[model samples]
Target: MQKPALDIHEIPSPGKWFLLSIQHLFAMFGSTVLVPFLTGLDPAIALITSGIGTLTFILITKGQMPSYLGSSFAFIAPIIAAKASGGPGAAMMGAFLAGLVYSIVAIIIKRLGSGWIMKLLPSVVVGPVIMVIGLGLAATAVNMAMNDADGKYSLTNFSVALVTLAITITFSIFGRGFFSIIPVLLGIIGGYAFAYTQGLVDFQKVIDAKWFAVPDFTIPFLTYTPGISWTIILLMVPVAVVTISEHIGHQIVLGNVINRDLFQKPGLHRSLLGDGVATMLASLLGGPPSVTYGENIGVLAITRAYSVYLFVGSAVMAIVFGFVGKISALISTIPTPVMGGVSILLFGIIASSGLRTMIDDKIDFGEKRNLVIASVILVLGIGGAVIHIGQSFQVEGMALSAIIGVLLNLVLPEAKKGE
Candidate 1:
């Protein structure tokens, strides 16, 4: 069968470009800012990182594909882990290094070929790992929405939370295509509208907030170290591996959409470097680490418009918004339940992506080695097991699970001849 011709030249007219850009912006808006909001980082900083990251990605890709880079959900668990162990700063440091990990992987792919990187993190491993990243946080989302910070569940908050979550889930499952992607946004609007009706929203801050102000940027204080926990760093490093693989997938999708060989021409290495630079820059500015956003991929898929300059426009818009304190405050007023509703779906989709990866790769479940690897990874990662080397250094949870799985796969003597 002949391959379907790629739609590479469907450029939008000037009027359409504005509408499409608005669509792309709305597509990524909710989840993009939620990362920092959840982690207690500045939402404006997230905006800046996302905008700046998108611009950097365009530069690296030589303005070939139209996509927006945003804050990644993958780093959410690690940021929480780091914050629990050390503080936001320590997690930011580790995540900043995670960006470098992407650069290193890019170099490896460039030197050894993408196939080598693929073999290193096959579907059998990545699938379960991604699932763990999502499912692991299931309860946390619920707790945050319904319960207080101290873990005590509140009847009032829980009720609103459930309603918001139901609305988001319903929209995602039964809504149309574009609606599916923006369920989070819609949920937030719905929840916010309800909250406003009930007089729960405090517009005082928004009124007090200036129309334009600079984002409060801060440097990571190295002195506030969480006592140098090697375990935490080690655990986070493995997650970076999965994200690198995801990065490759994002690039391929972009290339397919734009009808260009991005990995070969501007090269995956440069794109990865762009991500690394953006991430490091974000950390320095008190923002969460950055990654290539899948949300924007949906935008490209729908619009079929490929122009790096448009993303440049988006980046400029983000920077302008970053300086607007009132805007940030308004975004903050989006109730916790609203965010929870959207997160429930977003996190689940992340898990499903991992499953899709395994199925797409045709992973052999009958193989003993594969089964052992998959089973052990899921149990260790989600079961909340911890491994401590000493008082100061401890590897537990996903980090420990990932390391152990890798080791077992590498040295288990070929699974005893298929059991």
Candidate 2:
């Protein structure tokens, strides 16, 4: 690994702290807010909880693993599912349960090495499930890009989406260095500006919103009481399996980047605890579940600034930004088409990531069993196949596909040792 500009434990000067931290804030800002915007959670609360979660993570990891926690795109579909089946309360409850799943896994990884988990959820299972997570949302992106307030198809909105997509693609493929990593942020801003000229953006909400006020929170007990719903549980808990795998993968990549074996030093269990506890905290406060942001990882890689102090400073700024009502209103006012435009690229990138994972690991489709595993997973997940356990609960889509993939991998025989 390269020598980082800032060491993980180094405390920068007060001036450097503010400047370096703000860079991370920009790095994580777009994707973090986008999650809650898609899921109907308050963006302000998401910011607040993510900041708090980052602090908690730093504490738990003993500042050995320097990463920023933010809203997870993986949970977007399931949160929408849980919320639809029950309500916002149910969504938060399902998220809490998912966080519990993380804690349980952390304990297991602590007791035993993570080898068993990798065996259970090999690339064959995880790859396609991740693809399902991304492709499943493809329609949502298109619909938002084309639909108006009344859900009617509008060519005008579609144009905005197209513009947004083009700019994002330009930055992603053509832009150099730090600019390339932040295409999502730049695309949204460009699209919003374009929409403003066309009379598509409505700034009345922003104008009316107070400069300083408490951002509205959708608290579990206070907003709505949560009930045990197998429907929500079945829909959500299986997704945690995928995310835990994601967490481990992130640890590996980050460890590679920082020239420190994060898993060994902080220990995966303690770091996982930080992520789990952060998720639980977010659900309690009506924020989406948190994950270590890949965007911020990119920022760290480019800047070579690995300082824990930078992360702390950034997290503090996020919490501060959350209370500023003007920020909340401004975020809310971003046009749906603009969101949709960026989302098209975002979701597709997710699906592409699964394929990239397979390619990176040399997953051989020439092997019939491997081919079968991947084939079944794609169809079941993307085809929206459902398996009903009872009247009230069912496993479907991504969750169902993930469970089936694991079972099939377990049952399938390996090739001859000679072969």
Candidate 3:
């Protein structure tokens, strides 16, 4: 098997570090900015918070785990819902609570082992929930890709979206090495260029932007605070379940890549605590919730540059970039069609990953117990089943489904042997 070019502790030369960190920056940039854009948050704040989040994570983990925290896609819909219900303040409130959920789970895992959590969630529960998270946004992707700002279908916009998607898929399947991993970035660039040719991009934003600007930071209750809405909390906090599982899964994958049991050495609790802290920090600062970016992990595996210092450089660069007015302005100018095109692939991939999880775990649909759990989750999630609670708020969609799945898994009996 191939090994990383540089080991975790090995420090590269100044020049190499700069170049390698740039690679990680671009690898993370596309998806990181996309989340903020979709959720009506400022991309610049996302960058700043992402950088700060990573630094905090590294510090808390004692630099044993090499992970870059960025805006998490899982929270896109939740953030939007929270914002719509009560405004950005309520959204951040939910986000903060979501991070708290992570911290709480980290504490639980620290006290107890991971065995009980795994038993509570198993593939049957997790797989469909993951699918719902993705498929839930299918119409949103299409509307963005095909519709104009007026929400009318535009053939031009549709064409641009499809072209972007095509470029992304082509790169994903056939591009070589580093080119393959950065397909999202490449696709966005390609689509943006095409959209420019069609007069779809507005250059005024970039031209008018200041050279240096501080990212707008919105703290809950500082500017605007809404009344407590359990709906927002229920909407946002439950997605933590998916992301925490994602973090643990990535830890296992990273350990496998480096031929070391990270859970044993650095300890799963420490890494999880680091992630939780980073997320809480991000939410407090008015950025979207952060997660361990798989894009950076892919970069580490491909380049074999596992040094923790590299991420430090990347984080610093990210923060600096956040202060550059032009970068954020340019990122904003990227057309909805361009994003929609890539989002089509991304959202689908999210759902497909659910299938992959089930397959990897060999979840048997033939088993009635497993079948019922998955069936309920997929319907409740995708069908947008909402349960009203009193007049103030209610549980709906993914959160409701997730809660039901966990309960069903716990309540249902185990499958018989060779029934």
Best-fitting candidate, scored by lDDT? 2
> Which residue runs of candidate 3 sit more than 4 Å off their true CA positions?
1-3
Q: Sort every candidate by lDDT, greatest first.
A: 2, 3, 1
- Candidate 3 structure, TM-score to reference: 0.98
Scored by CA lDDT, what does every candidate get?
Answer: 0.75, 0.90, 0.89
**For candidate 3, lDDT tens digit of each residue in 1-419?**
77667788889999999999988888999999989989999999999999999999889888888888998988988889888888888898888888888888878988997888888778888888999989998888999999999999899999999999999999999998889889999999999999999999999999999999887788756766635577887888888888887888889888877777988878788888888888888888789998898888888888888998999999999999999999999999999999999999999999998888899999988899989999999999999999887976788888889999999999999877878
lDDT of 2 by residue, 151-180 (tens): 999988999999999998999899897688
List residue ranges in candidate 1 displaced over 4 A: 1-14, 148-150, 220-232, 412-419
Candidate 2 lDDT for residue 140: 92
Question: TM-scores, in order shown?
Answer: 0.90, 0.98, 0.98
| 1-419 per-residue lDDT for model 1 (tens digits) | 22322233344467765665666777778888889878888899899888888887777766655668888787787888788877766777787778778878767777877777666666777788888878887777877677744668776666666677777778778978678767777878877777576555788889888888877675655434433457557756667866776787888888876667987877888888888878878877778878787877766666555655556667878877888888898997876766776677777888788789889989878877888988998888889988776676777666777677767766765645536
Give the lDDT of residue 195 in candidate 3: 97
